[model samples]
Target: MRSGGLKRLGLVSGLLAGALALSACSTVGGDQPQQAGQDGGQNASLATKLIMGTPNPPPLSEPVDTQIKRDCPPVDVLDGAAAFRAYATPGSADPFDIRYQASIADTARECSSLGVEAAIRVGVTGRVILGPKGSPGSFRLPLRIAVVDEKGVPVYSRMHPIDVTVPAGQTQADFPHIEDGVVVPIPANRFRGWKIMVGYDPSGATQTRASRAR
Candidate 1:
């Protein structure tokens, strides 16, 4: 009877020890820290791009005299017969806040009998916030400009990238303003009408939703 009791006591003690060892191993493994991610597992920053305008193309098959009259109208003709210019703005009064000034010149001297120059001026200005309404962080934005014909075809394009940072839970109302202009010269004796298109990367990565300067 005494020997049987001793064997039973030893088995019970051994089972308890094994259970404690397994629990300890599990606790250690479960508590191990994981590797940090690139963003430190934090939320990503907000990004956006400005939208540009559509391209205005020159009139086709119009008589030289008529084409000149329409493009280099007498109202804003810089030169009596050789050159003309105009201006346009591409943004409104909401979330998408920006403007642009552009110029187009008619360089044809033989077609108009008078030297004519056509120019379009655009003015672009705006502000953008990078972080969430309350939490702010680093961000990247891209801007682009393009020249298109009346048929909505791209003739010339240019892009510029900008990087910015904002403070946490603060509104970034003030931003860098853009006051850039483009000049296009029409070849001599050419009678073509053209339009300029300005656009920005809406995805904050690529250009989208191109708009025309008014």
Candidate 2:
């Protein structure tokens, strides 16, 4: 499994330690709510949803352009912006019909004095059954996953490029991706309203069209 680093997010003083320690938290499965607030208050849990087959999550508090600049990784060493633009463009021809989609199969969380840390581990799976041609060389699936509060404020977001290898004569692939160390501040009263979302990044062109349509 390939690993990508999370760009450290700015947080209030003193809470960073708790968030940092999340890297070593225990893992769990199933839908049971995990304990959050360190004060022994009512526990809270994160809700997970499928980005492709479900309703879209609330609009992001920050604009897509801003997110692209901060969370998106460079497509290449030079002409990085151009590379991203090209990659975001929906393919129009054969073999480009790779049905890309993902879901949050399981989740786990750990809490401490300063805040709560959750792991939004997911299974990114896809099949090339509809392709008019054969499998192309191995490629990276660019996935943008985010954790948002009830008011649509983002607690954590990252663009994880999962490398995929399609074996000869195979039509599908599965890549396990994890977004650990997701720091949610104390006062877990709102944890029940938080949600973890996974999906493709809105392409620059898509955003532009939406802007004009509005």
Candidate 3:
């Protein structure tokens, strides 16, 4: 009886030792620290393009839906908002924020080389959509549309304050903005390398004063 009891006690001790060793090996170190991601905080860049003159293509010849004609207009309406010439630094915003969204949907350029001047008429259209939290109200959208060279030097910049009126029970608005007769000098040649960049301008009188205090 004594010999049998000794054998059983030895077996139990060995099993406990093995279990403790396995636990120690699994958690050799404390909680592992999470490593930072490689990507720095960067927003997806806005769209850009070289302007080209192209008239609206001929409309579809066959359309027999009678209600479609009465319900929707054939073409989009454009507001007669003038684009100004100004220089202001671009600002960044959270893309995923449910505040507002604005973008330059289309641009067309008509280049002319008259007696001694080279100019172009740039047509810009911006669309605004209010998010879930946005309410119907009147707000001015500061659109910073500028032309930059290859080295990202601003050849021309204008802060067009677009007056947006979100109608009652509506969450979307569309308007066309134009900056006509923009003079693009030949000395700044490399026209293909030139880029038209458009983004929101977050600078204002209140913010300007606060920045100066700092």
Pick out the ten consecutive residues of candidate 1 with the lowest summed lDDT: 24-33
For model 1, residues 15-120, the per-residue Cα lDDT tens digits are: 1001111010100111000111123312111000100111111222334465543452111112221111111223333322322111111111111324444443
lDDT of 3 by residue, 169-208 (tens): 8765555455654665644343546655554555642354
Q: What lDDT tens digits, residue by residue, belong to model 2 across residues 1-214?
A: 1111111211122111111111111122322222222223122222112211121223224332332213221111111110121222355432354343222222322222332433233322222221334354464545565666767687777766655555676544333444544454533453555555555453533554566589
* Candidate 3 residue 39 C-alpha distance from true site, Å: 44
Of 2 and 3, the candidate ahead on TM-score is 3
Q: Cα deviation of 137 in candidate 3 (Å)?
A: 2.0
**Residue 207 Cα positional deviation in candidate 1, in Å, after optimal superposition:** 10
Model 2 collision count: 0
- Sort by TM-score, top down from the best: 3, 2, 1
User: How much does candidate 1 score in TM-score?
Assistant: 0.33
Give the number of colliding residue pairs in candidate 1.
Answer: 52
Let me know the TM-score candidate 3 reaches against the reference structure.
0.47
Q: Model 2, residue 105: what's the lDDT?
A: 24
lDDT of each: 0.27, 0.34, 0.39
Show how many residue pairs clash in every candidate, following the order shown: 52, 0, 0
